[model samples]
Target: MNNLEKWFHSNLGVLRRISQIGALVLVVLIPILNKNEIYILLGNFYSLSIGNLEIADPAIVAQTILLTKKVFLPLLLAGLIPIVITLFLGKVFCSWACPYFLISEMGAKLRSIFKTPQPSLKNPKPQYYWFIFAGVMLFAIISGVPIITYFSFPGLISSNIANLVLCGIVGVELFFIFVILLSEMVFDSRFWCKYFCPVGAVLSLFLSKNTLKIKLNSVACGNCEKLSESPCINACVLNLNPKKENLYPYCNHCFACVDSCQNYGNALTITFQNKEK
Candidate 1:
């Protein structure tokens, strides 16, 4: 195996778990630190300020522009970071740093222990999510309020974390997240990430042909036929067929499929390639 593949094999899910957990820790710790009067990191996922660098969620940025009908230079600059990241890395924030996505993944793991059957809900088309995003933006324009950010699970959960840490109380947002998590466990897995999630939907708009994505080798994948089924597909919580080419706007670049493929034929590898390739 090559060096990259070798590293992926040895590390498996370690790096991702560390990143996800680290993000969760930051969500809570930032508020604690701020409560103690530290200002190095401020704000939550929707909008954050580290040192002098301001980073805002693009979805929220769009809403702000629509609501105010003007663009502030700082807001534009704050929004650029995530857009650049999405251009190069795809919508990795959902998989790597989203607090809600992390909790949802944990629920999926717990269900796996009980040997729960996979949710039979068919995956929605890419346009379905984009339509929701557009509709949300349109509503913000009409209602003169940024409704999308309010419904952003990641932002809401992180804000709630900050609220709990700094203010000593949690809001109704936690209950909303709990309901979503419970529904995911009993019904469809990653239902919100797949279907709704305006943040994910907005981030996906930056996906380009040259962005990072999962690629499959059919010959190596065919070798996986020796087993009952492809482990890559089983590893995908989103129920994506990694052996197929159409992964994106849906893929969070979690690398679960690539890691699972390593045990079989190392068929799936993440690479920067054209989507049509």
Candidate 2:
């Protein structure tokens, strides 16, 4: 009969945020270390090789398959690892590691802090850009080079950060990244992640049935008040409803609701075990 407040009260969200921020800081150093012969922690964006090992984005795998029509061993291994992780962990990379998510989050939080009125309440679906994503990959195949790394905000920012730290070539992607943030600042803050990012959608596609999920205890709690400022609704980074059914594939597993419910209401919980029984 232990409540979620007593069962779990630690701020795992803060730890998760810290780890993502640290990973972003490391991205800048990766190229610098390689250039200076100091150390090679990893490579950039799609191509992340650690020491002697290699790992790449699965999109890169798709691009390779499209372009060369042959599986390259190193790149295959690189791509497979992340795809495998996505199957078990869902779209965790979006929440836990993507540097661009952190940037988007900071913008959203600032908007919330400023009490700025959202331009509209209509949520966007990353699926809206599915055709555009397909077009980009088709371009990669036609050009015989992965152009996704160039347009991907996370990839673009990381590359620019690394290059800027090493030399002074500021990437044009920096301007595009700011345009994205400005749009989020003014309208549809969670729109990109919810409806536009092909990367998040790709990872979401591989989610296993037993992937960890939140469990809202109805026995110990009452229905949410239909309020514009409900704690669970406000706490969601993606602006999703915890009380709503079928929240998976979009939760991002941030556990912010667990924290919010602990402070404001004790009805919500996160558990690996299914709560259906």
Candidate of highest lDDT: 1
Give per-residue CA lDDT, model 2, range 124-207, as digits (tens). Answer: 343444665677777787887767665566667777888887787887779877888889888778777766666765666676
User: For every candidate structure, what is the RMSD over all alpha carbons to the true structure, in angstroms?
Assistant: 2.3, 3.4
Model 1 ranges off by over 4 Å = 9-12, 119-123, 226-228, 275-277
lDDT of each: 0.81, 0.71
> Which ten-residue region of model 1 has the weakest summed lDDT?
116-125
lDDT of 1 at 75: 98
Model 1: per-residue Cα lDDT over 34-129, one tens digit each: 989999999999899999999999888988887998999899999999999999999889988998888888888887787654533234467767
**Clashing residue pairs in candidate 1, if any?**
none
> How does residue 206 of candidate 2 score in lDDT?
72
